[model samples]
Target: MNNLKREFDASTVAMMRQAMNEVVADRRFLICQSVTPLEVAEHILEQAASGERDLDRLKISVFEKLSDAA
Candidate 1:
């Protein structure tokens, strides 16, 4: 599903929350000066927009984006 052009539904939202929670739980993700919850959420939405439906992948993508931003 190409969520890039559509509004995210409830399940997609739930997944993003779960993924964000997991990402923030990590100490490594917390110390990054450029990585904020809002930033992570935006990246999660970007991942979803790219058609990534897995929670793990969302978390991973957020991490990767953070790393790149660092």
Candidate 2:
């Protein structure tokens, strides 16, 4: 039983580390994109102005969906 618990804990830790690495890689890729953050922010603001409600709320919802997939 102790061995099983140890193995499960190790596996969970490894998965968490891999997820962290993937997030870092994704951020790097986004930063490398030609589009700047200001441009994206402006777009989001436009979207909000067009009756999209709170822009930050939408962003959080989208990110949560993506995180679930990961």
| Local accuracy by lDDT, each model | 0.81, 0.42
**Cα error, candidate 2, residue 2 (Å):** 64
The CA lDDT at 50 in model 2 is 45
Clashing pairs in 1: none
lDDT of 1 at 27: 77
Instruction: Give the Cα error of residue 56 in candidate 1, in Å.
Output: 0.9
Q: Give the TM-score of each candidate.
A: 0.79, 0.34
Q: Number of clashes in model 2? A: 0
Superposed by TM-score, candidate 2 places the C-alpha of residue 15 at a distance from the truth, in angstroms, of 31
Question: Which runs of model 1 end up more than 4 angstroms from their true locations?
Answer: 1-5
Model 2 lDDT tens row, 1-70 = 1122222245444543444344334664254445444544444444344444543454553344344434
Best-fitting candidate, scored by TM-score: 1
On residues 27-54, what C-alpha lDDT tens digit does candidate 1 reach at each position?
7797788878888877887778877889
Best lDDT among the predictions, by candidate number: 1
Quote the lDDT for 65 in model 1. Answer: 80
